[model samples]
Target chain A: MANIHDVSKAAGVSVSTVSRVLNNHPYVKKEKVEAVKKAIIETGYIPNINAVNLKKGKTHLIGIVLPFLDVPYFSQLVQGISQAASVHQYKLVLYQTGYDEHQEKEALEMLKLKQIDSLIICSRKISLETVEHYQQYGSIVLFENGEDTPLSYTFIDHYACFMRALEYLYEHGHRKIGFSVNRLEGANSSQRERAYRDFLKLKGLPFHKDYIFKKCLNIEDGERILREIAAFQERPTAILATSDQVAAGIITSSSNYELKVPRDLAVIGFDDQPIARAMQITSVNIPLYSIGQILFEQAIAVEISHKEVSTELMERSTV
Target chain B: MANIHDVSKAAGVSVSTVSRVLNNHPYVKKEKVEAVKKAIIETGYIPNINAVNLKKGKTHLIGIVLPFLDVPYFSQLVQGISQAASVHQYKLVLYQTGYDEHQEKEALEMLKLKQIDSLIICSRKISLETVEHYQQYGSIVLFENGEDTPLSYTFIDHYACFMRALEYLYEHGHRKIGFSVNRLEGANSSQRERAYRDFLKLKGLPFHKDYIFKKCLNIEDGERILREIAAFQERPTAILATSDQVAAGIITSSSNYELKVPRDLAVIGFDDQPIARAMQITSVNIPLYSIGQILFEQAIAVEISHKEVSTELMERSTV
Candidate 1:
């Protein structure tokens, strides 16, 4: 309820003095600082942060655009970002796009409106031009999208990880193999699919279109894929899934059919998530947390120097 | 960078007239409105949202206090809240407590500092007194804690759900059952533990503490519990886990030992999450999305009337 003027009057000092105290500006006398503090306490003064942000031309807020907050992958990344942001005394404003182009556009408009100082886009449905249009307003960082223009990002080498898993499976004498992926439109999924195809071609093995299953991201999708696999006359000896949760589904589904893993059907998954470790479903552990750390660092750097950053990968046990 | 003065000058009107037009006041003349709009376009005058918030004495921002964003249960709840907040045109400022007391205190301080208009305590580690202190700034909504306070909330009946699961297992002719819980301190886990004890007492079965495994929230925890069970001289025929993910871990661990579900170890889990349904793990289904919906409704009601709300439960599979 109290404004700067009220604090100034109550402290018996000039408004400029109170302002300096609030901003922690140098050259304020200790006696005047004490007076301002007393006035702030007595008047129950809560500084208007929005006004402060406007005056400073920065909000100390970072916008995080992700597909969905409910997904474990995004949530984990958010956790890492949150930790890094907190360490830097910054706050996060979440924008859930649900992988919609319109929503992504609207979120970018918000960032352009100065509601946030910077943005960390986890994944987007809009074109690069749209993102570039808002680049003038604030720094933009990408996560797992692998865009190489006008922004910094952190991502895993999906192709290498997928190939490693496949190579390991092939070396282990598993000729019949299958894989389940999400939408083929995503950069990561597309890369994984490409690796699957290329590996089979290089190995001189027949690439059966029926062996590749798409549109399987969640548990139900995994179940559907397993059901399809069960109906196949020549079942694959090994299966590769996009996530550990999906792998759990396949393993559980196999149990219902009285098929044992490794003995009947070996399964490997990506994103060595906590659940994966718990289930011990051999998976390619991507450094998701580290990606978050790098993204956060790049965001800070971009905020300070207006430069771009890139991504790296960390290997783990799936293969 | 143009302000209200620029728009006013360009429109040949007083600053108050431009302010009225910007605020959507009903009294502005048609010609004046057109002139103001034209002036706004010509000068690229963007309204200062922070200044407007100051005048209205509200930020239109909500603070969400959560434990961890990486977990599926909490993340799904966040998704629901995010969608609801977006629809209502409110922004969320997230605070991750990681169940730490110091972090919770800092979050409370942020609430008092007016960073957010209202506070949503999703899963808190702070004491009741600390929560009561921050309630003075804005309405506080509890999610899943079920604390009997004046705070508005939406939570599931963990006791009833656990009882139902146990009762179903009893009717299925299972006497020897093992129970697994995440943590004994969490409010939800404590409620489930109490229900399990009561069920055993009602059935006149000796309550063996050894049969009750604590600290099993994730799959690894579930696997550890299974290993412990396997080492037991006399093992139970059935297992009741706090979550389906943990149940999956147990199943996976059991498979390694050549044990079967329903045949060697009948397994039941709480929170009929998607993975549970996909894996066909018998679980007491709690309508989490509905809970999220109800919580959002309560939050909106509290924001409007400055009053408190309560919780309700919805049933699904498992039990």
Candidate 2:
């Protein structure tokens, strides 16, 4: 196996100069650093980063823990976080927990084990109290919802966002409206549900728990939701979906059932994703990419206490 | 400030037992393992993983480099890779390069710097020759269109897949068919283009470069493609979109242009994602999730060989 000595000999540099370049020390000359890199490649040398980081007491790795990656919302967040972290020269290590508490615990273990420098929690099934204990290891930035006492967080105000969706449906002469969410008990879903109930009560319309659809995460879930909506005797005239995928599914499935959107059943979708824009589905535009960007920035910057990412309503033909 | 002594005392175990549990020694008692974990949480001890790995010479971190995470194809691949890596007890470090050569180079740097144990390049703008020299550092698995010497690669036969898509269009009695791709000169795109021209020649039809649409990555690009198709003085009767998002865009955009699928413009998309299933769009089923699973498995398996995944045609509503 080739070593630092071989790299130094091949590059015609001293052993210490090769060491400095491998350590990412900025004081080394650019050409010398380039030569060392080329020599290392030619010699096929491995630097033993574990040994280097042991001496330096640091690892430039940022851990991002979330439920899913295939979904549009989380993927957008991942993209934003990856870009922001890359700008800071930090790599992202993902922990896709998928509502499994054990996986979430393993991610926290990474922080405690010094396997990563900092952590960004996009969403967690674990309680804030459980995650708070690991704050001493590194900066843990929460996304979507968290208390501001011991850690920083970046999230949208979902209650207000849902209120806008509800208001838009009401203005279009739709009194009986339904909605969809990924989970019934998640922090964001509960907040939106609260908004749904309060808005209906303020307008003196009846709120039915049966009208809310849970366990809808993808387009398939959205398609299944249509059947449930159709089965309701006192069905809604319009629906506000928690995601664009769900709204898109309903619109596409509506054709199969001879149900035309707006003319037969008005629709409002969340996330204003590309599909939403392409289909002209009225939506609550949560800046998921910006939120992901802020999550990484705040986690790495380690300066802010808390921040709120705003969501706007994008009105289109669907409603 | 918590140390080994504190953990030992707190767990009511000897210092040696704590060390054994920390090292993941198999002979350690189960209850002692639980106690040590509990003490770890109680004392908030931050284990120096760098020091431990320095002696063992293993990081157990597998690097996964790709273009984008928000797109369906890449995200599905990410999900599969993450799941497969998690099962193997190896964590994935993602470098979402987004077509940036510098970022792609940074991923290669990680292997040389010993920051990652191995690398799985999902797709790259970097040449295979440039990546070939890094095989000595560790296993570097290429995702698509890689050589079968000194490195392992897992890829689908895009040439065959595109030919099937083209033949399907031709057999349906459509003489003219255009296609969309993310990049014009990509290894897979160029192969598909060659397949397009070859199939046209075999059928005694002239190939037109104007029928091809390049630089399409998302649904918005598909929407834009509709306008371009309309502007064509002699447009194709059908389209073979490279991705499901682009296909969704074309289908959705068709409504605005008063063009009906199959009747006016038959469309076929690649990647049988949830969006395709929801839209009932005919597509080429590339097992992206399985390919990602195989990428992680092969990169870690460390066998010196290459493999090819197969694709299928899903006939649905659009075609």
Candidate 3:
């Protein structure tokens, strides 16, 4: 109920001094800061955050648009973002679109409307033009989508990682290989699919259309892929899944059919989630936390310097 | 950058009319709404969200104080919250505490500063007194901690879930059962431990402290519990884990030692996540998404009526 004027009167300081103390500005003298603090405690004054955000012309809020937060991959990325944002004294606003196009549009509209200062898009549902339009308002950072655009990004080279996984499988004497991927709508999934096709062609191996399985994201999708493999007349000896959680599903489902991994079915997955390590599933370990740190740095830079940034990859044990 | 005055002038309407249209007041004419919409589109007018929030005396931003966002349980709950919040046109502010007391305090402070409209305390680290202070500013919703308090909460009956799982194991002729849990500091974990001890006592079976393993909240923790079980001089025939992910870990690790499930070891878990069905790990199914929905309803009711709201449980699968 108490206003800035009341705090200023009580503290025996200028309104600007009270504001500085509230904002934690380093320029304010310790004595003035103490006076304002005392006044605030005594008055039970709660500064209006909306007014503060308006005065600053920016909210220390970052928007994170992800397809599904329940999954391990996005969840881990969110964890990274959370840690990075906390360290930088920024809050994260989550937009869980569930990979819906309309939701993506809505999220972008919020960004353009200045509801959020900047956005870190982890999902691949939005078009490049949509991203560019939103970028005019503030920074738009991409995650796992390696599309070349004006917007900055932090992503793993999915093509390179897929190729590496395939080569490893080939070297390990896996002649017949199959892959399970999510629907090839997002730029990231498309890249992984392209890598799979290219790797098979370059190796002079027959690319069977039946070997490729597409489904929704998650562990259940992986289990469905396993069932499809089991129903195949001629099943592949090795499988490369899109995610570690999916690989876990395959490995667990295969056990039900008396198929032992590495002996009967060698399986590999992407994103070295905690489950991957616990299950000992071979996977491409992307530095999710580092990506979060990089995105946060770029977001801060884009806000402060008004410049675009780029992406980098940190590899781990999956390949 | 255009304010309501600018939009009103461009639309040839009064500022009050524009405000009425913006607030969706029934008194506003359709013709005036159309005119305002056209002006908003043509002039690229975006509402100052901060100013609107200030006028309402509420930010419309709810802060969720979670340990981590990447975990499936929390993420799933967040997904539910996201959908529910979206329906009510509220945005989520994620405050990842990572079990740090300092971060928890900071999040509460932010709430006190009116940065967030409501506080959802999902962390097990902070004490009840600290949470009670934040309740003065806005509604505080507790998740998975059912300590009887004046606060609104959404939590599963952990004691009931644990006992049911144990009863099932006992009925199936499994006498020696080991339990794996996360930190005991968590209210849920403490309840589960108590249930396990009480069940053993009620069954006239000796309870062994060595059979209970406490570790971090992840699949690796599950695997660690299995390793501890493997090293036991007298291994239990059945295991009850705090989560399905942990059960998956135990199953996967047991497979490495050629230990067949059901025949060699019977494992049951809690929170029957998606993987539980795919892997056939019998678990206690908690309505995680419904919990989110309930929390949202409670938050909205508290915001609108300034009254306390409580929680209810919806059962699904595990047992």
The prediction achieving the highest DockQ against the true structure is 2
Give the DockQ (C-alpha) for candidate 1: 0.58
How accurate locally, in lDDT, is each candidate? 0.77, 0.87, 0.78
Model 2: docking quality category: medium
- Report the error of model 3 at residue B232, Å: 3.4
Per-prediction DockQ scores? 0.58, 0.70, 0.62
Candidate 3 C-alpha lDDT tens digits along A164-264: 87888899898789888777766777888899889988999988888877874678877788778888888898888878878878877787777778788
CAPRI docking class of candidate 3: medium
Worst 10 residues of 1 chain A by lDDT: A305-314
Ranked by TM-score from best down, the candidates are: 2, 1, 3
Residue lDDT tens for model 3, B25-101: 89787899999999888777778778787777787788888888877788888888888988887879998887888
**How well does candidate 2 score on lDDT at residue A310?**
82
The best candidate by TM-score is 2
Per-residue C-alpha lDDT of model 1 across residues B1-319, encoded as one tens digit per residue:
7878999999999999998998889989999999999999999887765666666867767778887887677888788888888788777888887788888777777677666777788887678777887777777778764455667777667787778777877887888888888668787788888998999999999888898888777777778888898888888888888777788788767877788877888888766677777666787766566566666667656443222222222232332
Q: Which segments of candidate 3 are over 4 A away from where they belong?
A: A1-44, A144-147, A172-176, A255-265, A303-319, B1-47, B145-147, B255-260, B303-319
lDDT per residue for candidate 2 within A95-203, as digits (tens), equals 9888888899898988988889889998888888889998888899998667645788987888988897788788889998989888788889999899999998899
